[model samples]
Target: MPALIVPTTRLHTAWLEAHDEWGPGSHEDGFGLRPSDEVDSPAGFAAWVARLGRESGQATIEAHRVHCTYRWIVEGDQVLGGIALRHGFNDFVQAAGHVGYGIRPSARRRGLATWALGRILDEARKHGMDQVLIVCAADNIASAKTIERHGGVPEGIRDTHLGPARRYWIKIGRTAT
Candidate 1:
């Protein structure tokens, strides 16, 4: 079974395997990986994990980022994917949504995204969020279904800096069956 755990340096090798599978890009949405992040080395990866921890409790205005929690989807020693739960709303949150996730190509079709989203929703509720927005690429049918399965209500599609995406709103207090 897969579980969501806070990012840690111990998973460095496993995380790199999953990251390699995504090929070369910053598209691993939930990892909160920035272009400046030097995750190739142990020290760099540890620093990145530390930065994520620091961002979890409050917004880092100097970095132009919001408060958010990052969790790795792991099954035993293997890293599968990641999910992010934003604590509050902002222009970026409005466009990107409160949650974002991505499962590695090798791990797709295993319902990992749905499971991770559900877990992250619980985190959002703990953070006192009554509702959360989630957006997926407009063409991503699989992702849409995952959101819908969690009681996500359609909020239409809109163009983002990344491109057009379909948005959904999930009421956090509602049963996320």
Candidate 2:
């Protein structure tokens, strides 16, 4: 089975390779973008990752280290996609979740999202999140289905800074692993 690999400094080359494949318009590319445009390289990503680790403790943003960033790599070699898990509060309840994921465009419709999210949900439980709030765009039917498949229960939908988002909650022990 494919496993979730945490991103690390040693995998910078892999990250670079994936970034090149996905390019700037992809959601994965958004992770590399910053306000100052200074974070534009491997070294910059490493620094940014380190900074996010530090900031996660002080700020409400629970963005974890890449080691904590879960990925679904087939045969443990091909990185299909991943979920960026960041801890959250009230705002996150309405918009963001503890996790955000995307499959490579070429790898879509292959059940990677369901697998990746199932793994991330396990990680959330390991991190002491008894209940997780997962939100996706109301219009994102695919994502909604993935969420539902993973046992997410519709809590409500709300408007946020980005747009309309549907919020779902999963109680860790309620579902069998």
Candidate 3:
């Protein structure tokens, strides 16, 4: 079974390979793709991984930044995908949501996203949050369906710097599916 693990260098190569195959990942909420040059070297990549892990675990963040936890969806030794769970909502988080995830292109259409998201929702519940928002690109039918399956109540589309996005609010532990 695939489980969510904290970002670690052990999965860096596998994660990098997956990202290379998929090209730049979904730039949801300013977590843009890593630069190609940086990902080219092992040391650089390891530092990058360490930085992201540290950034998320910070007890205090700048006003513009928020605490988030980065997790990898791994099945045994392979890193299949990732997710970011924001600690709380700011103006940016309000539009983006508490949870954002991406499955490698090769892993798409195999029910992985739905499963991984379900796991993330369980984590969110543990945080004692009443609700969380999840947003997807407006035309992303697959993502919309995944969110709906997790009890995502449509909050309508909103304009973003990238483009229009579909947003939904999920009440914790509701088990709509």
Best by lDDT: 1
Q: Write the per-residue lDDT of candidate 3 for residues 1-177, one digit (tens) a residue.
A: 878777677776787777776665444222223444275577877766665664453222244486766777788888788777776889868877787888877877988889888877877777776789998999989999999999999999989886999999999854333
The TM-scores of all predictions, comma-separated, are 0.92, 0.73, 0.84
Tens digits of lDDT, candidate 2, 99-149: 677776677798888887887787677666677778888898999999899
Query: Worst lDDT window (10 residues) for model 2?
Result: 57-66
Give per-residue lDDT, candidate 3, residue 168. 95
Clashing pairs in 1: none
Q: How close is candidate 3 to the true structure, as a TM-score?
A: 0.84
TM-score of 1: 0.92
Winner of 2 and 3 under lDDT = 3
Angstrom error at residue 71, model 2: 5.0
Report each candidate's C-alpha RMSD, comma-separated, in the order given. Answer: 2.9, 4.7, 3.9
Model 1, total clashes = 0
For model 2 the TM-score comes to 0.73
Best-to-worst lDDT order: 1, 3, 2
